[model samples]
Target: MTTPSQDRPTPQDRPTPQDRLTPDELRTLFLFEALSPEQLDWLAERGRVERREAGEVVYREGEPATCFFILLSGALSLNRVLHGDDVEVTRTDQRGVYSGATRAYLGDRVEQLYPHTLRAVSDAEFFVLPADEFAYAVRTWFPMALHLLEGLFFGTRAANAIVNERERLLALASLSAGLTHELNNPAAAALRATAGLRGRVTGMRHKLAMIADGRLDGAGLHRLVALQDDAVQRAATGVSMTAMETADAEDTVSDWLDERGLAGAWDLAPSLVAAGIGVSWLADAARTVGAEHFEAAVRWITYTIDTELMMGEIDDSVERISELVGAARQYSQLDRTPLQIVDVHDLLDATLTMLQARIPDGVRVVREYDRDLPSIPAYGAELNQVWTNLIVNALDAMPDGGTLTLRTWREDDRLMVEIADTGVGIAKDVRPRIFEPFFTTKQVGEGTGLGLDISYRIVVNKHHGDLRVTSRPGDTRFQVCLPIEQTAEATETAESGETTEAGGAAEASEDG
Candidate 1:
């Protein structure tokens, strides 16, 4: 519990003579049901019953675990802390249900700390045993189980660390590859446009010298400059043409250029047509320069339009490259604060941009963003990983081709982002175990089954948010809901189980 409801009772409460359990009474507990009478007697002699009034805490999480507890009466709640806020795991009044020092049998091999905060929802009683005694009893009485438990614990731990790291590397490679491919197209286009622009400018210079070789007066030169400006304006504001319209227009321009004896009529006519310049503009240029200098004027004007189009191409290519870089920066959140108020749309868009190379043309992506949604405090890069995992998962689901829809909006105090896809949905039998660690319906090697598990920790455990999914044959929606009013600390570390340090918030770093 982040805030205690009442003063925590000091750990001075002790059992009276009647508070102890006899061997027969201890047999009633499920844990000791199979133990021998001598073993039960050993526990009965050492264990005692303790009482906690309603609203009093039995144990706070992260404290050195000193006792083993089994509920005897009343209700209790288990709460986990994240960002200094309590997230209730469960509330139960079941007799014989256990809590506190669950892993005491492992002894000093691992840190003996309470994993969750336990509080008395109502007046409660627990049969408590000291950690050392419990550890000794278990080691001596159930040596086989002790060995098995140790193996299970350490083996699962080792397996997770190894598999998770491998998954992270593979995911990193995929992301890097996708980003590299997405970046290359624009970079190559810009390079090509720059090369073409150089030759166009050189040709225009030679045409300028030929035209101004004392044949044309100042008025003709001025008219040529005005016509060049008009061509640029038309290129910018030109209405797009249909394929048929463009073909007919280019044919007509080609015929006009041929009649005027201009070379490269076939090549130059398309450039003119593309700039929305027809024969009438060419004739006006002819009159301004007169027949004596018309050829030079047309060549000069054609080079001018060609360079304008080429320059526009270069601008677009450079702008595209800049946008990709910006998206990469946004997705990576490099050199930025770990936590901040961020627009959900920005993160979603950036993730989409990064995944662009992986998204095939058959699979369309649609965005349905509520621009009015309020910004929420979050770990920006981590949240981008969440979006990345969900979106990539959606893409994977749609193998044959389908729509991937990303929609965001607000509901009450929560901002909701839904990554929905049209694909064969999750099976009914498989749905319940989807959040469990390493549980997957997919074939081995194809999935580590940690994607949803890690995603849940980041959203629910780290951010105190919610992640849910709804599915059908043609549609599956994974929606993440985040609180708009974040009452927790602005900065928080992600150190849940399987995630040991900063910059590594569980789930293949959300790389999945």
Candidate 2:
């Protein structure tokens, strides 16, 4: 009986298969599959044919590779031993080729290390080709090589697309979280006040039913009716009370104010008294109305209080809406032409106004303007966008909040605007890429990274100006410069037009 090793043909003893094909067949195969007769002959001479029994390991993990193998028959499995788990990478069967041909392009690269284990799922045959020979075949076989590379390229691109989509999803999640946090405060306050208003209205309805039942006499009924009237009027006008109603509202408001320990309640009392309200009106109304009617009056008073608070909140909501609209307008530079005569000071002031809410509580802005500076012909909207972006960025940098200085002056007939911040300055490495599109140091979702890029385009390209930054740790300054006068060519054209008109008039006089 022959041993397994003895039964297998050694490379030196194998018959060369290259001699089986004619030159014409070799040429055709070379064009289609990169296999030449001479190379085939060499492979046939040196290559070994190996048979793997079912459940046999063709090559163990971490073993040195002497040659690459291609599946000739049956199925072969490739696996990675990762963290004690055998992870299958791929499987190949008849008509499916494997070998260094698949990894020839990645030769010796760290990512292409060695001995990814191969196993046979059933009885199989493999034609083992040397790495060098396989690489040579791939280089010469354009069609075969192109086919393999196309699959690899597409696989890499698909992986990159998945990674990008995951990143975008994470970014959107962060933005949602921020918006939710911002909206919660006002939404919660509105809900709570609405519930309280409901409770107050319910109490007022109970008091009205008591009066309708005839439990109170004419004087009591009159007093209760008067209280309701005054409450309705106060709720409508937002003025606390009229002289007669003041006496009634004062007792309620004073008690409410005192309970809350609010300052300026006394200051408002004089105004209420002057408006014709006195203590007698409230005391007499309470006496005639009785405790039940008095309780009803209190409910109405509470309703008025709640309504005023709700109205104030509504006013605040409106203001917030206005701010958002203003910011959007400033950001979009709406209604402004691409090129127009613009006052840089006015543009800066408008941007500052729009960004007023973003400014830190204690931070003050100081502006030094050159009053005589000429109006520049520029894209007003674009310049406004630049100002808004830079100012907002400066505010963001100053979390602890410091003064911002805005300065404008003329430098040799060119207008220069400098916005300087007393905030933590940009780092050395970060400064270089600050103007690059989509490059930002802000925490993700806090910025879009296009602000400085858009600003740069506006100042440098649209307006034919220069934007530069100078910074060190706690101080950063952005300086923008724009030409005050038109280009020389434009100036020359104007002068030529004037000269032509003069010459035409002179010729006309001579002819006359």
State each model's CA lDDT, in order. 0.79, 0.59
Give the per-residue lDDT digits (tens) of candidate 1, residues 95-132. 88887766778778777877678899999989999887
Model 1 is weakest, by summed lDDT over 10 consecutive residues, at 503-512
Pick by lDDT: which candidate is best?
1
Could you report the Cα RMSD, in angstroms, for every candidate shown?
6.9, 25.0
lDDT by residue (tens digit), candidate 2, 307-375 = 555656666655655554554454345666655677888788766765655577878899999999999
Worst 10 residues of 2 by lDDT: 503-512
Model 1 score (lDDT): 0.79
Root-mean-square deviation of Cα positions for candidate 2 versus the true structure, in angstroms: 25.0
TM accuracy, model 1: 0.84
- TM-score, model 2 to reference: 0.42
**How far does residue 340 in candidate 1 sit from its true spot (Å)?**
2.8
